[model samples]
Target: MLDLHHIFAMQKKALFFLLALCALGWGFTSYPTVFAGIAIGACFGTYNFWILVRRMDKFDRSISEGRKVASLGSALRFGSGIAAVAIAITLPEYFHLISAVIGLMVPYVFLFIGVFVSSVRNKGN
Candidate 1:
């Protein structure tokens, strides 16, 4: 019911575009660290997003079967975000902490945008 595959495809496309922008910034701009941080965070963010979607799909299945599911793996996702931050902190010369933090949120931003666009498209049909 959720069209999860389509959602993931859209998100992947958006993240790839973002990575391209990060590449450009890293190459052309003065703040290479900032772009690098964003790129790193986005990569981790994409992984986290995939995990969430996969868990959600399982959750839906569990519900349909009248069974109990463990959780959405918040701990795993939290650890991932922490790991990204840790990487940034460990490499202070190569990555900006604030930018990495912002980058971690990029996937959710794209998710919201994609949902909004899909909703609008559906309404138009």
Candidate 2:
């Protein structure tokens, strides 16, 4: 069984990799569209991260109360990369460059935020 820390680390690494891929893709693609994709992806990624954190907090509370906690489904749902990719594919041609950059950066930003939040919470305890 995976511990919380292990799970967190795994998630963080996945996010980082996703971000790097997005950045690399952006660099290889044209401008504008890539930037737009990145911007949109970042917004979505941040939103997903926050939602996952809240859900995890709730799950922890449930566990403390002896209730059966949900599996990692929520996390998977929140990290739905398919949605991000779909959005990226739909970006306007003129904004493709920006979108690509954002796509790459968003994942890394998500991981950073998650790690920062986790560290802060651990320190508080």
Model 1 Cα displacement at 102 (Å)?
Answer: 0.6
Q: Candidate 2, 75: how far from true, in Å?
A: 6.7
- Per-candidate TM equals 0.93, 0.51
lDDT of 1 by residue, 59-82 (tens): 999999999986998999999999
What is the C-alpha lDDT profile of model 2 across 61-88, one tens digit per residue?
Answer: 8999999887645656545555666655
C-alpha root-mean-square deviation, each candidate = 1.4, 8.6
Clashing pairs in 1: none
- lDDT (C-alpha, whole model) for all candidates: 0.92, 0.60
